[model samples]
Target: MNAAVLTALIALVSSVVGGAIVAAVNHHYSVKEDLHARRLDLSVDRLSEAYMFMLLNLTIDKDKHREYQIHLANIQLFGSPTTVSLTNNLMRRQAGEPVDVTTGALLSDILNSIRNDLGLDRIDTADLVRLNLGDEVDLLKRESSK
Candidate 1:
């Protein structure tokens, strides 16, 4: 082969190899980022469902209990470490365990942890108070009486 032609071929091969390496690296990172995003989305959905179930006091209802348990399991699977810990504590408190914090306080902490995990602003514990309308209160009283 002519010296000049050989040099040109070598340069072309080097360029092709370098380009492939860059493309592969970019693809690997893209896949990682996509997986991370999907996991975060799932975490958000599970947390929201579980939080709603807690807020509605539906976890106590026998019919809804299984669904709530599923949500809790999903939360454990997808939540950050702090979120998981707080959720476990909340469950323990619900089970009549001697957790030091009041139910409302523990709920607030769990909400704050979830917010932190989802990159939202933390809410004040006092701001997390539950409000029930007269009918809702009456319904709860009636249900508890049963």
Candidate 2:
């Protein structure tokens, strides 16, 4: 090939290679980000479901407290350390291990974890504090009544 043709060919080859590299790198990053987001969504979903079961467990008439534990255990597979700690408090409370915590506190921790995982701003304290205090109180009373 002539010099000009050869130079043009080299330039085209380099451009194609560079473009491919960039695209591959971009795809790698996008996939990584997508996986991270999906994991977080799963964790939040699990936590939300667990919170529901926790509420059901609170009702003295129900016997689904043990089922509530399924969500908590699943969180361990996908949640961060803070999430695990918060769930542990609930476990302790259910076991009547004299934990110095309340339903509101556990709720707060779960809400905070969900918020953090979703990359949301700080939650309003007033909203988090509105949890009915009856669950923990009732659990205590039930223990004594038993």
Candidate of highest lDDT: 1
Candidate 1 has its poorest 10 consecutive residues by lDDT at: 136-145
lDDT of 2 at 43: 79
Candidate 2 residue-wise lDDT, 1-146, digit = tens = 79999999999999999999999999999999999888777878888786666644554334654565566687666566766776677578768887655655555567677777778865753333223455434442333333
Clash count for each candidate, listed in order shown: 0, 0
For model 1, residues 1-146, the per-residue Cα lDDT tens digits are: 99999999999999999999999999999999999998777777777777777667733778878887897787677766765776687688778998543435434555776787678898765533345665434333333334
TM-score (C-alpha, index-matched) for candidate 2: 0.72
lDDT of each: 0.69, 0.66
Error of 1 at 2 (Å): 1.5
Among these predictions, the greatest TM-score belongs to 1
Note the residue pairs that clash in candidate 1: none
